[model samples]
Target: MEEILQLLSEDARLTDAQIAERTGISEAEAKDAVAKLEKDKVIRRYKTVIDWERAGIEHVFGFIEVRCAPERGVGFDAVAERIMEFPEVHSLYLMSGAYDFLVVIQGGNMRDVAYFVAEKLAPLDHVVGTATHFVLRRYKVDGDVMVERAQAKRLPVTP
Candidate 1:
């Protein structure tokens, strides 16, 4: 299962037959394992990490460090649910540091993200303060390089 998970994690496009070939398992077993994983809620969603900039799609990302006051019974889960409900929120995490929640937001522009933080996020019931960092450029995302690295040209060899 771990082997199947690792392979799927690296490349979600891998078919059961491919997984079987790599993991030295029978195709039927591989299919059953993958099916069980999905049914068990282990494999949640398959995603494609796209280079949106190269695709000519203009967008902006903001990393927001949110300071919050947790609800007595729920801790941060209550506020987390609210924050995650927003369409702009790409990802959210409960952190252990100066900030309580680390929120990643994607928007059409810097102003749009700023509007979301200032107008929407800051006004939330338990939210105390926020520090937002706008992404200038994306070198890599999800372990995949966004830009192609320049290859070194070989010098002419004389015999």
Candidate 2:
């Protein structure tokens, strides 16, 4: 099962037959395992990591470090859920250190992201403070390098 998951994680498009061939298992077994995983909600969804900049889309991505006061009865989960309900929030994570939640959001531009922070995020009851950092470039995402730097050209040494 672990082997099957590892293979799928590397390339989600791999068919069960391909997985069976690679793992030396029966095709039926491979298919059953994958189906079980999906049924049990272990496999959430397959995703394609795209280099959006190359596609000529103008997007602004920001990482917000949020400091919040946890609610009395529900704790951080309540605040986290409220933040997650917003469409602009792509991902949210509980973190260690200075911030309670690390939020990733996308918008048309910097001003749009700022507007979201000011209008939507800040008004939340538990939200204490937020620090937003705009992404200048995405060199790598999900272990895939988006940009490859060119090699420097050098003159041959004459000696």
TM-scores, all models, native as reference:
0.87, 0.87
Show the lowest summed lDDT stretch of 10 residues, model 2: 150-159
Compute the lDDT of residue 125 as modeled in candidate 1.
96
For candidate 2, the lDDT comes to: 0.93
> What stretches of model 1 exceed 4 Å from their correct place?
151-159
**Which regions of candidate 2 deviate over 4 angstroms?**
149-159
Best by TM-score: 2
lDDT of 2 by residue, 113-148 (tens): 999999999989999999999999998888888898
- Which residue pairs show collisions in model 1? none
